[model samples]
Target: MKRTTLSERALVLAPHGRDAPIAASMLAESGIDAQVCTGLPHLIEELDAGAAFVVVTEEAIASADLHPLSDWLEDQEEWSDLPFVLLTSRGGGLERNPAARRHLEVLGNVTFLERPFHPTTLISLARSALRGRCRQYEARARLIALRDSENRFRTLFDTMDEGFCVIEFLDGPHGPASDYVHVQANAAYERHAGIPNVVGQRLRDMVPDEADAWVEMYRRVLMTGEPIRFEQELVATRRHLELAAFRVEPAERREVAVIFQDVTARKRAESELRELNETLERRVQDAVAEREAALAQLHEAQKLETLGQLTGGVAHDINNLLTPITGALDLLSRRHADSDPRSARLFEGALQSAERAKILVSRLLGFARRQALETRAIDVSSTLEGMRDLIASSTGSGIELRLVPSPGLPAAQADPNQLELAVLNLCVNARDAMDGGGVLTIAAEQAVVGPGDAGALRPGAYVRISVVDTGAGMDEATLAKAVEPFFSTKGIGKGTGLGLSMVHGLAAQLGGAFMLSSALGDGTRADLYLPVAQAAADPAPVGGNDAIRPVKPLTLLLVDDEDLVRAGTAEMLRDLGHVVHEASGGAQALAKLGPDHKFDAVVTDYMMPQMNGVELAGRIAARDPGLPLLVVTGYAGGNLDVGLPQLAKPFRQADIAAAIERLVHGEKVVRLRPRRDANSAA
Candidate 1:
């Protein structure tokens, strides 16, 4: 093998240019590659560039500023211990010089030699220092490999398909390992168990019902040193659980690892399959019965699918028609300026009717799964209390209205306004059902539901609000279709049949459940189950009338296909002190904006012939990246994801002004009252 070189590459810090070359020659003879640095800055640069060792003269370290050298040494990692050699005079002046002594203390691994020292001695010292440095490099390489291995393991643990946890057996006051503490767990453990923040918690404290049995099973595993696998019911979540537990061998403490999954759905499916087989045998004896059963199921499925498609299409078209009408009303309101009382009242009545129509459309669309909800934490007791007067009026003198609220009930996580609407709808239905005048009770209470208890709802704490009525109850068949849209027993023109359907949609969309129970002669009880909020409800702020800010004159490019909408919007912009330029389409707008021509901002409509707003934005970005763009849309299906500012149709003058102000002044303005992205998943 070839001879190994000492300090394979070296950096010399010698302010004297002539002394640097001499040092390089001495190191080169020993097959070491060496470079000379002229000053402290140059020396630091060379050290940062990865030198094996640093060599300097006593005069350089003593006379020159050594603060930089001190800082460089302070920044090194524990694994890094760079070797250095100092050439000093024959006198032992370094011990007496405080500055030199301080520099020596800062540069930890430094060796010194007199001027008359032998070349072999210097070379020998370098060889020893290089050997120690080689070990450090080896240790660093091992540390990096260990970190990579740990990251890989953690990724696999977090993405497991089943729950996994490590439990350490704990001793009770008079029992042998009667409980266990969860020491470590993966992300999937929380998801599969439907429990969060489980680490460091004892099993007995978390679920007292199953504590004894679960502890006994693990205790057996530890005693026999054998693994056990079984399927059993989890009492806490009421779920059928399949798990395997084994003692961790050679561990210092008594520990075991458990792996499990909730198999409730599988169990239910198996039970249904068995029941269907029994029914098939009976139907085989009567062939006509089997065919009729299959035919009825298919017909019901197809009818619902067809109705949903038609309703969704009609709702979209109606919303489009309402957009322009609402926008026109806004402009008219501004023109009237609340100066005439008669005109103002007429305007207010029309606006209220229009708003009611919008809510009706929203309910229809919501039942069709084409609407979004704005969810928040709301106090159930307070919401019911506020509606006491309205509920009493809705029942009239015929029925007695009662409100009963449970004490210390937690707030529910839902949209406050939507929850109010759901409660109101339930009350109306109850009142109509009790045609002969009876008692109507509305009550709210806290409840805990488990995995397989509440249908289609996960295990958690909930706020259950019930509305009971002493009414003429419906039969089983009618009760089954109570939540179906457009399914009603009321006479023609009596109701639209969307009350219960809308309530059901509201609960589902807000991540809750709705249930209705009734009998032919008895009363009816409707329960709305909403998840309990973890935090207190936020207080609603009261505000006075908003004062509009005056806008400075700005040159703007406005693009839209509709002449009426474009004209109305341009008039509004002009009123705000802006000089507006109109373009009927995106192509026309681009032509107006040539290479040399520019404007303050571009405002364009999303749906247009030839080129849409998003495409226009892309072209503008390519030409002038700094120019700001805003897109307006009347169509409901626009999917512009360029992160440009957007305003929905039917926007008031203040809405558009706020959107523009956000773009120009870096002020945060709330976008047109709570809109979910059209492309977002329901």
Candidate 2:
């Protein structure tokens, strides 16, 4: 419950007579609430509680102790000047009566009324006191509101992050506007300006050297009543400050308020950056020629990168076209093995040509860095000896060919097919370098590479196969770019300029390096280093009908976008005694797999429209995770991370049967398990 406030009412003190009652009744008639007190002490108590004004007779306090009442009048608030109407006997006015003068001293704002006065006169005086009391109440309310607003502003001003101060222009021994005094400042002033107790200090005293500039800047704001913002350095403190100054309202006062933040760190950083840029500009001007050469090399590299991407794409399409043709020829060769001699020879030639085409496609993919290498340990000496006939035929009979292999050489780890291609490219390059009859030496030996080797090879055992030719060699500049794609020295139409680059790529892929050393008129030597294998060499598989066939026939789903590729694969599966179901693409394959249909395994081409093989495998796995999946693709760079087996394109009937057999028997098959990404998983 809220306590009642009686500040608006009047207090009456007429203890000995009807004066108090009569005065209270009169004020009540005029719409005023009055409280009647028995004595001066009671009236003082009522005043403490609250009252707008008081009405008291002169005799009530003439002989009594008036100290309490006097103290109350002195203790009133700044906004309060309580009015008092004294009811005195006749001739009781302050000028005529000595006792009335005492009351006047005690009650500062008092009016004296004689007892012989009319009732109208008493009522009129009482109302006049109440009117003055009302004005005091209004003043008290305004003072309270002003104090609350000041409190809020004080809180905000002191808590703000920026330094704030009010400065008043002063006319000192100097001239007008020559100095200023800080009238008020917040806590942050010391933090930002590095000055303490500045509220009463003059600008000239605090910063004697810098005061003039600050005074001039603020003086303009005062005169024009405009705000100014600027960043300036305080030389004495070695600090930079961003400040805004505005003239205070009622410009006659000639005062300005300043708000500032320290920006020393930002200013220093900008200065350092400017100096560094100037140094860079000088260095760039000095190295213009060298930079141009490097830029030319970069542009050539970028072109080769683009061509590699195009080559990979074209290789994918070519592999798809070759798949059916290779499969058909292999099946036909087997069916007509005992045919007439001429027909058999013709078939053998056509199959050899197709095998050559496949090798060419593989080399293209290798140059594009998209071919998945099937690396294994192999005897380096045996491999070199096997390629001896081919190398001799390519170099022509005019050139002398020699093979030098160290006895009991360790095996090296590499992809056999890619390894052959790389060596062939190196030998052919050596033959081209020899314009006349020259000797070509092919040497292989086991060597240990140390940490400080020139090839940047890791410290390990390796087989270094060097192809040294005694022929007209290249100069240093030409040799430096010998391994760069499209940098051939041969006539434009005679070379594709990718042989050395392909060799370099293959070496790097197999964890090795290719280095060329040559000088003008001297011979060129190409070294191909390969890592030594830790395990024994993997024995080459012997082809046989029983080894390639599955134990039992399986129901298989064959999916491919290309009609010929799909049909050829389906026919191969049927020839292996498996019931085959075919579909043009992933969506059609999904539509064909209904609740009534069941298959032991799924084989889908990787790159297709609408949906790819990985996605189809995922949908099928969601329905039945136990179902085995086989992804057949011509594109070797696809992300096939669905935990399925993969078979490369241009596979024969035996390769398909072997893949299906492994899938059915739950055996791990060799595959390209590319890295999984967000899109492939989804």
Candidate 3:
């Protein structure tokens, strides 16, 4: 590798006539690059710019009163010797002149050279002078660097954000106990300690109590030879400070240096923050109270709106049933076949009409109160397929409806009839949105929202079905209160506005979120979510049981307060070939079933004042271990609490048969009828 090292110049500043080049040549031969400066004025700039040496001639140096260069040379380190070469024609005579000798005597290191000398003698004097100058350069560079470094250290200490201070040992009885005297302190440190003119003072004299604390701290540090840090608050000033101290080597002895920073403002800010938090907590409590009151008002409004929707659903379904009946009756009346006397066929038609009327009555009761839910694992897609014709007919010819039902949708646990009603409400809402003529898109898709979602949805997969309308859309403000009870969009007689609120409440009870998105001129979309049912066991296929032998008939108790319903129901039971016992109400029925009579099944209505179906079922279940009790009613409220089976009213005769068979067999049914769950499976 190529040799590389930095070579320094040795400059010997002297007058032009003194043969500086000749002197430099001698030093060059001695392996020192020496140059004599032309003037004293340029010495500072040259030396600062990294020049090495300085030399002066005797005639110029002795007569030169301005000793700027000499003073600068004296400030150098002790190892430095700034050499000066003197040229003398009469050497001994020069020494004899008292004034000249006095000046020369003071300049001790300079060599005297007699003129008319040999090159060897002249070269030796110049080389010796240059050698001394080299020593001066080394000393000056090191000391000056150290002096400049002190200013750097002071600048950093003063400019730091944290207050800093240095304390030195002092000479006194109190000082012996104290850590050190306060020798240096930054501006912030002085203000915090409340000590003025802090430098070069005894710590104990300035701050007596603080001095005692420092004594205990310093003693530990000296004994352990380790640094210590502590945070404390001043009792008098209530100022918080962080104190740090360590052992350091002083010029002549070992001393401990301590630095303390004030943290009072930070502590005060934290206190204020805690106070703000308390204020915020009070505000939150007030808000919660207001929210509870609002919810109470909303619940009252919902009760009234629910009554309105029941009336509307009743009116709508009755109107639909009338179309077929009225048509058949009109045809019969137009024929005028009196002699034929169509009694049997007319009685059958009357039965169908009575069945329709019964359905309307049960639906009315369902709306007046809550209804008993007949839950089952239903194929919602299939049910939707059944309603395809009804939905199309329900909407006007002007509205274009696109029913995009998912073909392979998962099975949802729901009451098929109730779910049908809820879906009909959605379709009605969509039709109302498209007043003129527009496409209403109802699409179903599977979705998953996990934790960290903005809505904070539960971690599970859900079926999301959206009813999208290309019609007059709602604004953001309207969308926010869209699901509020009794919040109507249509004018006075046109709507009760319970459509969305009911949808929301029902969905919430089913453990799901009800979401609505709409923008002016864009569209309105409602997203319905429902939790998925985990298939804990394989799905059991419930096949038609025509091949299996029927179980032996046992006594069946049929109970109802309504005379027409009991009589009509008894006729239907006798037609099915069963031993039946009829009772007017729950109390009369219980007296008949008392000990002597053991019934295979008990079918009763839920909303009886004397003895409710639930209460009767509970009494019976408490009394008998294995008797199967089937609760038949239109009013089932909340969740089911017992093992008794439930069946909603307004059913086909076939519906009664299927339910009784299932209860007798003790088949597992879905909990409460989940209309919203249908949306999930779809």
Which one wins on TM-score?
A: 2
Per-structure clash totals for the candidates: 0, 0, 8
- lDDT, candidate 3, 91-171, per-residue tens: 524445444464454554545555544354544455444444554454445445544655555675677555566555544
User: What TM-score, computed on C-alpha atoms, does each candidate reach?
Assistant: 0.49, 0.54, 0.41
Candidate 3, position 488, lDDT: 79
Error of 1 at 566 (Å): 2.7
Which stretches of model 3 miss by more than 4 angstroms?
A: 1-386, 405-419, 450-452, 531-559, 585-631, 637-682
> Candidates ranked by lDDT, best first?
2, 1, 3
Name the candidate that leads on lDDT: 2
Model 3 scores a C-alpha lDDT of 0.58
**Candidate 1 lDDT, 42-75, residue by residue in tens:** 9887777777787887778776677888888787
Taken over the whole model, the C-alpha lDDT of each candidate is 0.72, 0.77, 0.58
lDDT tens readout by residue for model 2, 567-625: 88888788778899989977788887889789988899987765778878777765776
Model 1 global lDDT (CA atoms, 0 to 1): 0.72
